[model samples]
Target: MEDKIMPTVEELKALAIEEIDKRKEEIIGHAKHILNNPEVGFTEFKTSKYVSEIFSKLGIEHDANLALTGLKGNIDCGGGEGPNVSVIGELDSLRIFEHPIHDLTTGAAHACGHHCQIGSMIGSIIGLIVPEVKNNLSGSIIPIAVPAEEFIDVEQRMLLREEGKIEFMGGKQEFIKLGVFDDVDMAMMCHTSATNTTFGVGGTSNAHIVKYVEFTGQAAHAGGSPHMGINALNAAMIALTGINANRETFLDTDTVRVHGILTRGGQAVSSIPSQVTLEWRVRSGSNEAVVANSKKVDRCFQAGAMAVGAKVSVTNIPGYMPRLDNPQLQELFLQNAGHLTTKDDIDIIDNSHNGGGSTDMGDLSQIMPTLHPYVGGGDGVGHSETYLIHDYEKAVIQPAKAMACVVIDLLSNNAAKAKEIKEKHNYNMTASQYLNFQRSVAEVIEYAPEG
Candidate 1:
């Protein structure tokens, strides 16, 4: 009997891309379906069920209800044992009430194009699981659909934390705490962008800390007795003013961002506000700057309470770390993307370029090699009503092809490239250290006016 000649790397890539193209309509339909039916963060029961059904149809074995509404599917290649590679898709939407496609009842909108992420994730799986492709590749492919990447609905998340349903707000953070990523060696995901370029590789995101604040005061009829009651709204306004005032002190390099939403001001306009609540965020280019600026903002909150002679409570929740994109993984993604589009059409961002945004993918990057590249097909501002995906092919199908090809390259030769990247990569923190650091960051500080 003659020994069979194994397929070349280029041949494997071609096979994967061909499979993705064959199912292009099905893949794009999934994205549109998700966009029409959006869910927010941990409350993504519908979206979770939808993705689970799709995984079931594909005959992928998976665990559901992870981190409240996450799904992890496992696909073992016929080639052999090797490093596990994760393809992640976020399964949450922003609460953009005015969005054209927003859910009327829930106000959830896929303004960030996370729906595309899910579609592309499924597309990549579809391509890789082809009999011819999987038979030649080593290692495993782990497809994940995670919830709560937006970090919104903080009050509800805090309640979840209190009930022990979750220890962290972000899905990836909760997954880390639950040891869901223990077996995974490396990961990659694509985000939808509205940039002029077709694809972008290499860029950093800010580290951040989430803040939940409350001020308590005495309530009285505003028109009847204005002097008899303390105003919590006034206290909140003062705190916001203080935050803005301190902005000048922040260095440009630190990229400090302090922003928040006043969730509750007063129940009725005729009465003084006895309670005021705010959901705030502090973001910076580095963890150190995030910590330093968080403290500064906390002091501003305390000052507000001091000025109003009211009591204040501030809860500091661990937020996402700055992104650290793996250079080798990025190069692989870029090469594959160039094949799908002209090389000049792709943007190569500097490693130090911080986008002033935050993502839980950053948390994952701290422990292992990760890629968070961007693909274009959307228009208007992200996380807003105007943001919408115009070309499903660019947003979903092309990314799927690129990611699938990258995985083929990594796992084709007994996962030679995957092993090489893993061995040379330096982790910023071990999983345990990361958990400890996040736990330490969780604390509640209460202050009452000194008598």
Candidate 2:
């Protein structure tokens, strides 16, 4: 009689990588298609449909429209009895009108390299779903398409909130509120970066609060009888000046970032502006600093309204928490990434190294073991017009293979790696506590000085 031999974890990973490599063209093509047809957050109908069609073709069981434009698909491992691991992709684009490939009408652009995220995510799914790989793993894998990670479109998102479409502006935040991450035990995702370095891990991000500001005043003729009207645009300009004036107070160690844009300055040039709107963001390294800076920014808004006798409304929306990457999970990613590149190409920063940006993934990391690493394939500045993917293979295939192998490592051996991680992780907060804290951040303050 012939003896039966079980496949080793490395053999299973090799099988998955081979499968992913086989479909490289298709994966890269899909990413390019997404790059050409960009859509903004919460309005990714066509993009959602495209992702759903691909999921259907892959024969994966998926639920769509969880948070308006988000989608989740699941594949259970035959080995069974282990944690559920999630591979996530962002499905929205930034509004970069000046980008060369930006939509002519909508101005949506993939300047942040999110299109590659979907490609790498799908590529990882393709790799892990190979029958040979699935049969050997002991847990499930979830490939999810998430929405609105950029945190733009503040006015429109606030409208969505009023209509009860979502409780939070960020996709992951809303996903948490909707119980989308409830079943998932651990998560990992790779973001495309302009860095020529092959891979990066072990860094933190800023915590932040979102603000929607509106200044209202009386409208009158711009060229004629201008004295009869109050200028809301002037009030907004004063508010912005006040904000700038407080910049010196920000501590260098705190890494405070306060920025905003005037989304709507006026109705028409012929008329005095009656209302002006702004989308503001306040971010800092620590949560306490974020709270303090947010209060100072609010006072600046009030100062603007008081200076101009305009009624100002500031709506504070809860933003992301500082990112806390699981050390164990990051090591797994690093090990997998090492297979494709030399150690010199990878940069492993300190856990306290703040990237000076914010992400809702940070919010998820507060409650679960999550990994948000960076991979190279892109050049030019992120969120800028010049940003473009220069190497699809590095941006897509390598990360996909790495993520797949990481999953195999975690789920193999009856998911010993995942179990160890879960047992050792000391979560910062529970879902209920996170929700209460976010809700407490929500408030609408109206400041109208008495005459």
Candidate 3:
């Protein structure tokens, strides 16, 4: 379609700089629309449809509702010369009772700014859709408007899995199971952040956290023989206490964090809780280290259960993977970002954000050389009700340009970078193996009926 798209490294940077500035209003407006209509996880029906419509208008071919609510759109702009890379943008929100822009359909808000992610991705995709850019290709640029990144309603998803509705616990993982990412090369994505880093910022490598620790125990009237009941609430509290006591064991650089809440402690305040589900998360510098710490954290639950004489189930559902920085991808992003910002002062977070939060992009990284950087959003805390667009135009525009710059460079740069990235991060997953991994996580988390 486009004259065998292959733009030089320099050309890629220049193209993004010139066009990104031009499309400023268009991209920001698109982001605002999505922001205004925040959709919850796995139910972004209208959002998916709207994204599909965008693809249709641009003449880009895409498939939607992958892994429940994920959307995948691809434009073969690299002219079959280099690696095929996917640009992922998560499209779900989590502010159920928080945020000014809340969606009534799902009682959710795009507090995490996932809505903005898809918008920036669309802007980047639009920039690549130019005839000259597409024809001068070096690799494939596929934009994925993915869903269910929040990992909400875990038990509901577990039931879905039991009924054979979905294979993976999360959207990206399900896409992986459906052979969605089995194709070409590298992938790039970004998030709206509050880290005070402007323009471009790369935080500490994130961990692939397994996100659960549930508890169950016998119930007895608190006023009448409380000792007779194996208090599940007590078990959960014991787990929390153990984790807090062990916090000092975590290395400073490792940045170990473990915290959770008790869901379903008991209906009546006077009753000893029959069951409690501890929604917990553990994050660290590396997935392996995080997993190791997660295991130790699990021991706390185990000890708590033992202390309370109640059975406990611990499930480690896949969360975000340890976000790694690829010298290859980072250089490309920096070079592109440098078109607007200087290289010497290109701010990069060496110590990663240990902000006690997690994401699903970690799974995508295990499969490819993915870059999930932070672009600015208005200066309010994410996941809070007060989060608002401080400066919509600048906040949305810079991120959009940064993403477009990366896509152009990846799609137009020589085949070397793309090829190496694909080979290096190629998903080493077998369907059976992935299924087993899911089952193993389930086994660790499955709650047993009261005995």
* Residue 339 C-alpha lDDT in model 2: 89
Candidate 3 accuracy as TM-score: 0.87
CA-lDDT, candidates in order:
0.94, 0.93, 0.71
lDDT of 2 by residue, 276-307 (tens): 99999999998889989999999999888888
Whole-structure CA lDDT of model 2: 0.93
Scored by lDDT, model 3 comes in at 0.71
List the candidate 3 regions with Cα displacement exceeding 4 Å. Answer: 1-20, 78-80, 195-197, 211-214, 224-228, 342-345, 351-356, 413-417, 420-440, 445-451
User: Candidate 1, residues 238-305: lDDT per residue as tens digits?
Assistant: 98899989999998998788898999999899999999999999999998899889999999998898
- RMSD, one per candidate, in order: 0.8, 1.5, 3.7
Top-scoring candidate (TM-score): 1
Q: After superposition, how far is residue 189 of candidate 1 from its true place, in Å?
A: 0.5
Candidates sorted by lDDT, best first: 1, 2, 3
lDDT tens digits by residue: candidate 3, 81-107: 667777778877784675667876566
> Number of backbone collisions per candidate, in order?
0, 0, 19
Error of 3 at 120 (Å): 1.0
Instruction: Tell me the lDDT of model 1 at 282.
Output: 97
